[model samples]
Target chain A: MDRVRVVGRRILCGILLSAWVLLPASGWGAPLAPLPAPKAQKPAQAELGRRLFFDPRMSGDGGISCATCHMPAKGWGDGQALSAGYPGSKYFRNAQTLLNAAYNKRVFWDGRLSGADLPTLVRDHLTEAHFMLVDGRLFPERLKQVPAYVKMFKEAYGGEPSFGGSLKAISAFLHTIASRNVPFDKFLKGDKKAISAEAQKGLALFRGKAGCAACHNGALLSDGGFHALGVPENEQIFQDPLRHITFRRFNKVIGVPNFMNLRADPGLYVVTKEEGDRGKFRTPTLREVAKTAPYMHNGALATLEDVVAFYDKGGGSGPNKSPRLKPLGLSADERNALVAFLKSLSGEAVSAKEPKIPDYEIRKLGDN
Target chain B: MDRVRVVGRRILCGILLSAWVLLPASGWGAPLAPLPAPKAQKPAQAELGRRLFFDPRMSGDGGISCATCHMPAKGWGDGQALSAGYPGSKYFRNAQTLLNAAYNKRVFWDGRLSGADLPTLVRDHLTEAHFMLVDGRLFPERLKQVPAYVKMFKEAYGGEPSFGGSLKAISAFLHTIASRNVPFDKFLKGDKKAISAEAQKGLALFRGKAGCAACHNGALLSDGGFHALGVPENEQIFQDPLRHITFRRFNKVIGVPNFMNLRADPGLYVVTKEEGDRGKFRTPTLREVAKTAPYMHNGALATLEDVVAFYDKGGGSGPNKSPRLKPLGLSADERNALVAFLKSLSGEAVSAKEPKIPDYEIRKLGDN
Candidate 1:
């Protein structure tokens, strides 16, 4: 029985390999380049940032952390259509993957912030009411009370615990989160058999007929530019009253004219306040795309196939839809190949040892 | 400057150690025995259970898992006063630590079930609407749909996915969660310096004047019996209307007479429907007790110090208050020693590698 099973497995493998090789290889383009190694960060600074990132005490309710949404096990993005916010809230947009985020010139879906420095982003996220909801002034004092945090701050920054030092340390840690040397990278580095033949065909389609490289270009596979792709509205948002209120108030505060009139997300228009920027979202990198699902800004597309089909139809109709989006007349095989290529982009799984949080002992006044 | 810093650190360490040793050893008693290792489990069965434990797809929403609330990192509890239920829901009760739970004859604070076998507990937790909210019948079908799970199920149980098989596999995994060899255990095993002298004084008080051994006895430091300790009501439950409704309905369904009139938690009363059983909760094991806070069924106590103080006051006045309750007259030093001893119950940390969840591809009709 064992011999028969082994023979059967070999036959199956042979059939699958032959089928891949038999596919027409026309329209193949030059292989994409590998991602470059990120600059090394100080070990002490990165270590401190890691602990801070996982510490829920930094949040208002002390129940959420940076790792909650950007969990390393889930491709640095919680595999959800929308990120769960503080106990009573939900994010208006899908949680973006943190992989290769350092390569982006701007952060977040709407490209509201121009600087991608870790410290600036950490500070923004820490104090953002929509995120951690921690008061910046009080947060430092809270950390100062914990002896372990105080020690870490002094070691990482050569000073007492402060908001600026915390952000800088956390940023340094974020810089160390770069993923490199994926199978796609090996294929790009002249290893013809690094990825499956199906992936090779998909790579060809991505760069050529599919026109993915028009926006998804460069080592990170994103131009870091915003464009209106006319992605459809996620009706799920209407069911959540808190999310609806937050979305409306956010757009209004950002000076989005006629924000109430918008049937769907105004996207970049909320940041830029330009009518042409309406519904435009920053292009996302495709690194580790296979692990992150429920795609798009609102997570409207459930799968890569759905996303490809949407693009194949030149996206949904909108006033500011990018002209670059046109019907991609790709065959079924080509579409599957494209997905296979994208799957190859996944690198080695990243995991971090959870840091030991210090226990705070309640001391009587003047005891210490 | 460096030499001065080193001298200051040594002085601080000396002061802390000397303070511990200076505590009176008058109440010191015989040390407790170390906890024994759990029986070996079949590797294949446990491996299958580990995978299922971490697979969020097992839940109704395909989001929550056993590990969601019983996170290994936080001592098999989420380190919350109340466990977060399905995305929008909050549990009325705190998540219990699974460490050394196998030693119990009854499960849960209410002691609703007498059986301690893993499968029974797994089934109860899985179908509990306030917990995973997963329908047993549908859950098996969900697992069956996943090819990888089906293969694992077959290997582990020699059958396709079934409700019984899934429960057994998950139970097998739970059996592997036993924690032993804590510092207290090492001290009990004749390692005099395994725990601090303060902890030694605390252990003596626990076994003698503190009267903790009356309930918290045996290898697991729990008598596997119910006791009404008059734990305070968690007001947080009142803030959640759903929790209030669920609590009422659960008590009513269990035939609790005048459940509404009961102050705080009815606890074991709901299960027995005996008026005398009112407010009685099963004694929880002290294994990894330091990691699992706020203490008690309602999670009203915020710290171990608060828990010790509560006991020192001989518990609150209530109908079913244990007759064993009496003021221990423990001094400040004794209280600190007891807290230190409790902290020493924390064993080596346990962590499970996250299993890779297989993606479910939407196939055309009859494609499989």
Candidate 2:
């Protein structure tokens, strides 16, 4: 209770405060893990899938290919606020990049589909009127007409050009896509100075004060869980009749209740049909965050800075907003550092060349 | 001026009237001509065309073949008041029978396409969103993939599965679809008992008082000219949202003025772009009329009696109604005779069996 005892207690408190404020968090290891090395794929099937990926013949109008929405140049995304759908349609959500798609088995913003059953996922996109609109019974007939396709299908599946085989081929090619030579990987492998000093500082903030690692953690930089971040609706889904019609139809197909009055995208509610799941979306991976511009499920954030600012402001307001999302009171320098750290996760932009689509030939009957 | 002179004049007029009323008009033709013999087609080419006609792969979704609407069982017409269009769409007009389509050079109710240019006509029906909605660029790719189609195309056109060649092959087969063993044709060929006495009387009325020969004449039983008979609109066009949307899109595509406000079909005006041409549809051939029930461009007249009643009532009310349309003052017996005569124009329903659709065969890139 003496004056000397009080002075000693105050000094000890000051030391602890200075350490917390000035000292940096280690960026080396712990909660956030680096992505694993790319897995090998069968050459023939992947090659067949590569051909199908670029061929617009996969679509209803044969005017759009998979590359139409998932272009490699724009980090595998279309670089738009909303996706371009079938010729007469408009998509409600932003197209997710395929750069590290294989690493994340839970696909799509709402996670209505799983990548584990990639054929079904591909089939869904192919058959849906809003996408390719392919007729399953007729597509095989189409494949039979192209000799080159037939040859490839035989090699890939050891059988004819069946619908399931074609889908599997496309899926095989998708498996080949992965992040390449990321600096963060090298840093995780004990390479000092692989990331800039400022980026290191950002990494510290991401782990500690920003609290981003809570959801955006692990090798894929995602917990693979659904959460409601209270992201604002893009409004385009309702304003555009084409998009609105597709949205309404999608809801009806998924058996949502009272879809006629349901305005905003029901998100995970479409799959679960639960009131509590409303507006919840899968936590997206942050591996190639730098290259994919206009972030979030609806592309509401146009820049990395905007995304960082969103989290800094405690996210948007909604009754079901994730309690994990809270205000991150950080200095402007710390925010810049965090954005820099995200850029280090992406390496060289991944891409593949389009294969030659074979022409149809007619020979005199029995002559060949 | 004497009473006897006036009585003599009346007697002379009575003799003339009696001559017109009692004697039958010769069934031997002048305005009406027998259909020429069915044209001979190269067996290979016709066979190929037959296969194409039955192949649903001709459609976008591969669910609708050309024969889907033009079934042989229904005398080449779908037997629907309004046509079933693409999966999500509904057609505003009735499906015309293709029984004697070869003779009818001006195809379609609007006569926008000429059968003489069968390739273009087929293309219109195949590519129109309200019809098959085939992607032209994608279609040839589809054809080339089918090995059977390839050989057939080669035998038919001496070339690969080119678009023009396939269309030409189809046209060749159509040229062979002439009406067979029609009673009217036998009657024209000098068989006195070929037609019933009532039908002969109906023929006289058709040429004389009914005045049908003015527009419905010649070998094909049509003048190949446009006329407005004021056929009533089918309420289904407006009652169903799918049909309404397709109708609106069609009007907009045809460049109709104030299309948003244009509710009724503009008919031949779509081709002419003239206000006076509005509501004017082609005089459809009556060769197979008995089979295609729910007659007229709109199929508003549900039966032959409904049609006879329509003409008996001087056709429906419209600004562009044809002057040729007038009340014939036909009794129920006279109407029955007319219907009987129409029945004589048709023969046994024309049909061909569906060919076996080829399946896909794949070989490893270099394996045979």
Alpha-carbon deviation at B71 in model 2, angstroms = 0.7
Residue-level lDDT for B346 in candidate 2: 85
Which window of 10 residues has the lowest lDDT sum in candidate 1 chain A? Answer: A22-31
Clashes of each: 2, 9
Q: Please write out the lDDT profile of model 1 over residues B128-231, one tens digit for every residue.
A: 64566554544554564467876788788788777898788887787788875688767765678999999988988887789887777766677778889888
TM-score of chain A of each: 0.88, 0.89
Candidate 1 i-RMS: 15.7
Model 2 complex DockQ against the native: 0.02
lDDT of 2 at B353: 79
Error of 1 at A129 (Å): 1.8
Residue-level lDDT for A9 in candidate 1:
65
Model 2 error, position A270 (Å)? 38
- For residues A148-251, write the lDDT of model 1, one tens digit per residue: 87778878888867789888888777777777668987776667898999998888787778888777766677777889898878875654544554465466
Q: Which ten residues in a row have the lowest lDDT in candidate 2 chain B?
A: B359-368
Report the lDDT tens digits of candidate 2 across residue range A105-134: 578888988866778888988877667775
